[model samples]
Target chain A: MIVIDTWLYGELASYAGEDAQPGFAQLKIELPDGATMQDLLDEIDLPTELRGITFINGNLSAMPGKQHDLTQELKDQDRVALFHLRSMWPYQYRQGAAMLDSFNDEIQKDGDRGIHHAFNG
Target chain B: MWFLRINMKDRTHQLTEVPEKYKKLAGRSLTSNLIADEVPPLAHPLGPNNKLVFSPGFVTGTSAPSSSRISVGGKSPLTGGIKESNAGTPWAWKLGRMRIKALIVEGQPEDKGEFWGLVIGLDKETGQPTLEWFDATEFTGQDAYDVYPMVFKKFEGRRVSVCGIGMASEHAYGNAGVIFEDMSQNPSRFAGRGGLGSVMGSKGLKFILLDDAGAPGVEIADKELFDEGRKKLAAALNEHAITKPKGGLNTYGTAVLVNILNEAGGLPTRNFSRGRFENAAKIAGEAIFDGVKERLGEERYNHACSPGCIIRCSNTWYRKDKSEHVSCVEYESDWAFGANLEIDDLDTISELVKLCNGYGLDTIETGVTLGVAMEAGVLPFGDGEAAIEMVHKMGKGEPIGRILGSGTGTAGKILGVVRTPAVKGQGMPAYEPRAVKGIGITYATSTMGADHTAGYTIAPEILAVMDDLDPLSKEGKIALSRAFQATTAFIDTSGHCLFIAFAILDIASGYQGMIDEVNGVLGTKWTADDILELGTEVLRVERKFNEAAGIGKQADRIPEFMHTEPLPPHNVVFEIDEETLDKVYGEL
Candidate 1:
């Protein structure tokens, strides 16, 4: 249940152990049992240049820049999405996004190499 | 009385008369026709069952501008399908002037013993390729470029066109390419890709050198009309900054497309997993130039792929350590191996580019295949050093390297990676299809497997060649792809470079000059419309052969991963409907 705009710090995954990492941040605050959206972005050193609408459970949120509450009895495998800053009219893609996406990783994880040969199917 | 056939099995050669039917077809057209008529689709690509043919266009060796292209045809080891690849070099024109219509090299070695090389030179008065034997493979594995000078000195320093296979090609890797000596005695130009060099290597002949010393200029029916046409076309090319000397191409070459495509959000990074690379600017053409300038000096930046090329969009680059990286890192190679690998270091990509070239392999194919291998975790993604090691293994003919060298399709099978981005067993180029829809259609429909240069719809899709359509929209791509593919076939077959089409096709008179050259050389009366018909005929013949070889409507479809995965920078999957893909073959 982590959310950050992709373009802000994509290749910085190598800096996972740095001072700005979630737990190591000076402003880090544990979410309340029923804390709301505004409590999230206020805690971490989120990049200010990230601008766009945010999605929660596939529904668009009116106030995207503000944080949301996530401690509301969420399931272990609940999916949360942060729409990266990108163009979405004709098509939507993240600037500086990795070429291989989540779905590709899923299929790659499954080791289904024969999937391409079944194109006619 | 002008036919030459080299039988690789017995190390014997024969000279006979070419048939009348073949008189009309030459260059790209001749290559494709020979592949269709002679090769069995089911035949083992590396076995003696397949045949390799080389033919220059009918107008080749003429004073006509840009009339020095050669065509290489064979059943491809990479795609497991038929292919006819074309390249620009003095060799084709040299061979054509000798009235040599075609060179048919066939059969594998009977012994499967040690390898051999073919040394060819002119007899001074006759412009024909004469054969000699070289034991270069026995000593240092010297290639055509290295072997030619020694033999050329023996022939009194005569100019010759030599084609040879390097270490990787002799190993029959899918990415292996045939290297041809340029006018300056450099083995820089290649009839590369589609495993054409492997086809040559399988024939037991390491090289096919052409020394057409007394080659006569091509005959044209109307000299004045042709000259006038050439004058008009040259002037128009000079007018456009893109085609003119010192333009974007001449200055930065195709590598300029790196920054432009990144800004457009079409650059494929990390094995088609995303469309954008964070460090793209670090590997930008300008940065690469700066790196080279700091090391090799600025004078080394400007180069050309061949002689008589107006647009010198190529360069020889060096690393910050002042080491030679690659001679010419074009735009596609930069993106295909650079951003696509998630290794934004230009120097690393440059070094890998040289390794592929020196080993006689296609940069695009090797890059894309390596991208898939990274996804498979055979080597970690963005591991530039590991990728270079794998490429080196391919040169040495190692087993794992062989599997990867077969291209993405086979590589995917060997390593368990399902998200292999390719079409028809051939690897995709720089642009991710999900970002650029028109290019997507080109990949899906081009007869040449997953090739971008075959039908570059990017101009019409993004730059607006005639009508700019939204790249993501499926509308009008069918028509655009067909027209572009047909027109490309015409240009490729005419022995002219495709870059000329960008400026020439836009101008009415400039475009007509190419058609005029085609008509004048063959002595055939034809207009622009006839060119379309001839192009369409070429497609039909190729398609018919594919069908005969068991590649049907099913084979033309794109890989499943592209349709299923949503590429980022633009979270869009391929939106082109299947019916549109099927409709591409409608006219043919």
Candidate 2:
């Protein structure tokens, strides 16, 4: 048996267990050995119309969207984060920090032809 | 398209051909370019030398969604720099439909203290907007809460889109703003920053009412191409998780951000004393939603503030008597009045927002000013009622009220509080810079003073939309904030609401659609590079203007307290190096 700890956000929290609070749900999925991410999603009975971003072991599970990548196997004590209809922002703005080159790589990963505008120094 | 120049110096107005250089400008770009070119950079903001200009966005008045933003610009009395504050109101669409490219109000009237109004509408014969002057003595000295309804009644026949400076502006308060209507025509939306309204009031112009009924709307060169782009953009908005039906914003409005930021440990509390508010849940979007659902009637929640905005993340607050208490309460306003002041009650926060709206004050500025006063021992931190009373006293012109009305930095100076949370003389927003490090780059470097809207790095830093750049790490934010500011500068000129960034950032079709729509209308082809160039040009013009105004890299900094005083929860201080900060405008 494999147990995956998951945190669900927005409306996706309903399919999961009780939430600690809004946008923070604590639940564990008990999956049979060799069960894939899709199998776990199916067990959770998540809505098909619902599109979301998932994090497995603290990394993005799907690049394009959803849990359709069924071959990815679940593991014991893995951390999974499911977010549906959630958009985070500065509840007007939070600041500080420095600049990095990886920032441009992350922008490219967002898929809209990465916009990491640079200034000529 | 024509530029309507109103010379208050001689009580005359003229419609002239737009200068060739300014033919393609709109919104912030248009306003900044004009101010940089025409107005003296060193002119006193409230003096006759400063010119106040109003312009609709390039994409306004057409089938474009959320394109009804109107930018009001001039020398900022608050920042003493070139300023442009925008609002989502029907007046922008009205002006666009009337084929007016820009409306310029220049020079102070000889009788600067007298009240006056400018009425503009489509001429029956000419089918273009013409200006008419009127004596508005009756509504003189009244706050926007009292005067907006009167203007609505007086121009009921013309279906005029009205917005005006209020008593705070009449007092020439630097913290004042211009207030206008939502879709329901309640004067709730505002161009609420840098005190441009005071500039208008200084010119003795109390009200500006525009009517575009029976006039041709925006001229689109390629109708089919434009339609395709509009449809693509709308579809993206409808499909996005945040912008679509039953989205977090749609369900609870922008105040929903409270929990998200709280969980991130970035919500400022008690005037930058802490990053996380202990009672943040009390004013969270879910709590506000539950209140609206339990207390307010239908037709009050999930309302639209602009003519054709799809997101409609605005809501109204109603009292037990079922009377509307406030028109639209947003997240920053809620955070400013609620957590920043240690006022936990959502109802009281909404009431305080209404109080600022009534007085025509910037809620962020008002809250920051009040926070300074509280730090200085003017009032107790948790006293919501006292805060309300102090804002109400703004129009009375009392010494205390004037000090408060002047803004946060001034209030802090008078009260001997060095911990004023401001940059470039403008008060900080709800976000705590120390905790969310990326936005510190924005506050320290934005052309506009402490303006989050100038460069909303929240999407990448906090939301993890495009990139999950660590909010705590100071490595990637300079490039990140510069990108956001440039993209946002381009978006601001497009006339669409900044909220559309959610769609454009993630969806390729949406980004392409935004480009196509502008290209279709103007009959010009532009790529991402061209778009970046345009934004850079606008920033350069603004930078030059600020330089001439004597505000330079030395003034582009966060408050000193942010450097020495560490915010709690994260226990972080804003430490982005000044050398990196200077690089934000390096290209320009």
Candidate 3:
């Protein structure tokens, strides 16, 4: 079994059940080996739409209206963080930052080269 | 319109007709162009040859939404480069209403120790500005928080606004900021980077009080067109999800970016040692929102920083007893003292912000300086109490305090810390350059040193048409950064807050509304292309001045530490080459 270290921020902290703090919640969830991001979401019962910015081991995997990480597999001891919809990382601040291969591909295929305030997919 | 020049050497003032050349310029365009034309590039930033200029943006005093911005420009004591620091305040609105194109302070008092206050009011008969000088010696050497209310009471019963410097400026600290009064009369709003406050202090000026009662309002060339543009911009601001009522900004303030950047591994932590902070969530905008609700026993929305800001993004932090601790803890200020120092407590962060506001120091510079101090073993990281004590000593002008007050670059050198995260002698803001390569390019190449706002993102439609540039490539990123910088220059000149860029970039009409409003006021036919061209011209003028001041392209490189030392989380160093860095300003 693999234990995933997870964090939920803002209003999403309530999704962590009794482990939730005022502003954030952190929990370690034991999951079967080779579980994907979808399975982790199902385990936590956090609706996919509720998360805006998601990071897997500190690498951006998804943004609001752009969720390409559902099928991306999670590893043991991996750090996963989820933020509420109101949060923003403007394009200029995140232009050449690290991102999941699937997410970077999605951005490259976009018409404006993914230079937007928010993507409505 | 008039050009009011105050000669500090003799305490005399002159009001002249606005020159035809300057009539079309306002805000940063006016300030930068005026500085380029008048001030000698090689002059010592604090010397007699350096002049400080202030101008309000176009449409500032009109019915435009969120357009209360003032641009303060001079040679920077910190960077030794041309600088235009901006703030949103009613002081800018008042200046615009008085029809003063620019207020320039020139020459310096021989004594240097004595300070004078300048009271500017409209001459009822002539409809021109009148300036009266007073001995402001008594007001110096005190917290600006204490001085603001006294200045307001001194001009009681009039429509007045106050702008002053604090103890930091009085001591000629390189990190000093010019303090402007907020809506609540607190000296919290600031034109807070590049050491413009020290320039003002060096001129022997303490306060500039504007009383615009009975003054004619801003002249709109075409009222109908102006109203049309204003309504469009207002609708965009009201309808946009992030900018609407009770939206991201109004709900949580600019500190909202804390968790976002932290999650993306872009937040600078512990003197740029890492990209992520363990306690980032605790110090984020969402945390501020929740903390305020828990303390005040109710959910509280943010308030406007200036008179006409619809997307009010300024939040207040309250104590455990429900009293106001501070009017704001901006994202930069919060991160500078919080995650950057490894402090997770909101109360401690608010106290540091309040101290910086009172002492008139730039929060980014102070926090980064403290980070370097920590790296030097002057104090341990996460020691909030020690950090607070150091800030107090800085305000008191103690020897150690003065060393830190010299800013990040100077402090790093003095303390023998080699990993200083500074570009052009100014400390970097909340964003880690190594993690975010485009912002790194901006920090390295911006005429103003290490400014995040220097290259704000604009409309993707505008960007899409830029010759099929792929944002992932080095050339594409440089082109994009140059375009973003030009767009920011235009917005800075428009008198609207840079926050407007958030809504306008997404809504097409909102972008047009900005251009139309400027044309409505100036009666000039300016298209989107003209906006970019004008911004480019402003950059050229600034770059020319910086080059002459000995900060040429060679100085346009990120710190050696950022290039060699990899940031954790992503573990990426700034990989953009020098040739690409030059292209940011080369093609311009």
What are the Cα lDDT values of the candidates? 0.64, 0.76, 0.91
The model with the greatest lDDT is 3
Q: Which candidate, 1 or 3, would have the higher TM-score against the true structure?
A: 3
Candidate 1 wrongly placed segments (more than 4 Å): A1-121, B16-18, B121-129, B139-156, B296-301, B321-324, B457-475
Q: Per-residue alpha-carbon lDDT of model 3 for B1-588, expressed as tens digits?
A: 889999999988888999989888999999999999999999999999999999999999888999999999999999999999999998999999999889999999999788999999988898888888888999998988888888888888988899999999999999999989899989999999999999999999999999998789999998888888999999999987678889889998999999888978899999999999988989999899999999989999999999899999999999999999998999999999998999999999999999999999999999999999999999999999999999999998999999999999889999999989899999999988888888999999999998989998867655743687678789888988898998899899999999888898888899889888999998888989888899889999999999999999998999898888888988888889899899889989
Off by over 4 Å in 2: A1-84, A90-121, B297-301, B457-475
Ranking by DockQ: 3, 2, 1
**Candidate that scores best on TM-score:** 3
Clashing pairs in 3: none
Ten-residue stretch with the least lDDT total in model 3 chain A: A109-118
TM-scores for all predictions: 0.79, 0.86, 0.98
Candidate 2 at B140: error in angstroms? Answer: 1.8
Q: What tens digits encode model 1's per-residue C-alpha lDDT throughout A1-121?
A: 4332221111121122353221011122344444333434334433322423333322223112222233223223222222222211111112112222322233233222111111111
Per-residue lDDT of B102 in model 2: 89
- The positional error of residue A51 in candidate 3, measured at the CA in angstroms, is 1.8
